[model samples]
Target: MTGLPMEFRAEGLPDRVTIYEVGPRDGLQNEKTVVPVETKALLVSRLAAAGLTAVESTSFVHPTWVPQLADAEDLLTRLDRAPGVRYPVLVPNERGLDRAMAHGVTEIAIFGSATETFARRNLNRSLDASIEMFTPVVTRATEAGIRVRAYLSMCFGDPWEGPVPVEQVVRTGVRLLDLGCAELSLGDTIGAGTPGHVTTLLTGFAAAGVGPERLAVHFHDTYGQALVNTLAALRAGVTVVDASAGGIGGCPYARSATGNLATEDLVWMLNGLGIATGVDLGALVTTSVWLAGELGRPSPSRVVQALSKEQEPDHAQA
Candidate 1:
């Protein structure tokens, strides 16, 4: 009960797993310093070269809210988009979707919280009202032939509401799926979840006829349990995971929440488990090192730190 109920091992597992790269969007969004537009584009291009199939390029939210991503339009417009990959942007409303469409976005993501308290605290609306507002956004995006992914935030727990109800999470997820969401990302916004909690939730979804294939896991590393929960999910048949590079971002309103699991850390685990991520770990580490330097802090990834130490020469030997 303290951690994973049982120690799980990933041996002879599937050769490949899909990683939804959210560095360019989620990682950079919470950066205190505003990353230059050119730098943002470079990050996306590098991620593409590193073999990520889905790169969340940016959020189309208002600049007044997230000034770090104020250049979303510019970055999207100037990207040297890679073939055979999808770049999706976070669109909170019709205006955000319109802006994304103008930039030639082929895929967009709409997000809502599972609990009314979380919705009101983060978006200033009730849970029912928030869903009502996004129905049209999803409808128009579908009509325009753009794939939409729905994000169900605080599925695990919330800062204001505390432990979110499974029924509430299911209700919201069903609505989004009914609205034609290609996939639903269940977010542990506060990083207060454990493997047992995750299994309970996934089991509930499965019993409700929602398989793991249609679901993605988005975990924060607030308590360093993201990877632990991920291992649990994979054993349960989930293949898609959302991670950020350098462990760089968290929700502004979710107190005490850290960033998403580091891409390098997740990749290391997946690769070790024989999961095919198609990502280059060396390149990912390099990118994490560069971004951590830019952020003026050491990376939050334990794997990166260990790797860095191993590569360093023992000057004390002299």
Candidate 2:
């Protein structure tokens, strides 16, 4: 059996948190080897079996952008929607949304940039033009009764722009929320944020009348600050966190960004806090261990590495 963390209830943290699993989509997006649609289907099934409710399944972006997820439609067809799980797909534009809608997707996520530099570099447009682009996408999705999530990358820092201002991020995020997005996920695309920076940013959002309930955080581990920053966000009442299995994936457009906070690692910390994540830690570790084998690398998650070590050697190798 995999090991578990000791329980210690933490005050001011949510009793239960929604772990937005990004392993299938984000984890494989940056993979050099395109995972077979069947393998991705199995990964999604395993994550659902491990109790992650909101799994980011795939993206409808053009194949030129994310070739690894080119078979998003096929993956969805194979899975046929896991029971008790919500599989959200990324839709970069109206065309992508059309593809997602064709596949009967009920939830979609749109990614944006907080910094002008990243906006220009990633979207090939100015920040304002990108917002203009998202307006129609969000409006159409919401009108169709599809839940839309907006992602504000470079919310913390950008490799080209350096540290992004808290005010700018809030303003950009508020604009996205105004476009009818149900939730705005702030991303430290370069992982350069500190805990104090995280607290101040959340405070900025609060002052602007955006509460933690409508917010989520996506952090990379470049500076090894993702976990601490997450703790800060949780203290600030942000309950929805985005993580990848086996600590895989980073911003494909941003070279400096590293792997996201690992799901097993986050679950271990939450388990110790006596917080209910509805995730079976052993099952998750086993899944990630199996995933590591498929990737031809060991899992980068410390929890997965440690627990895998304690398991029978014949099982998922540590």
- Which candidate number maximizes TM-score? 2
Candidate 2 lDDT over 138-209, as tens digits, reads 999999999999999998888887878899999999999999999999999989999999999999999999
Off by over 4 Å in 1: 1-13
In model 1, state the lDDT of residue 288. Answer: 76
lDDT of each: 0.86, 0.93
Q: What TM-score does prediction 2 earn?
A: 0.97
Model 2: residue 132 alpha-carbon error in angstroms: 0.9
Clashes per candidate, residues 3 or more apart or on different chains: 3, 0
Off by over 4 Å in 2: 313-318
- lDDT score, candidate 2, position 125: 97
lDDT of 1: 0.86
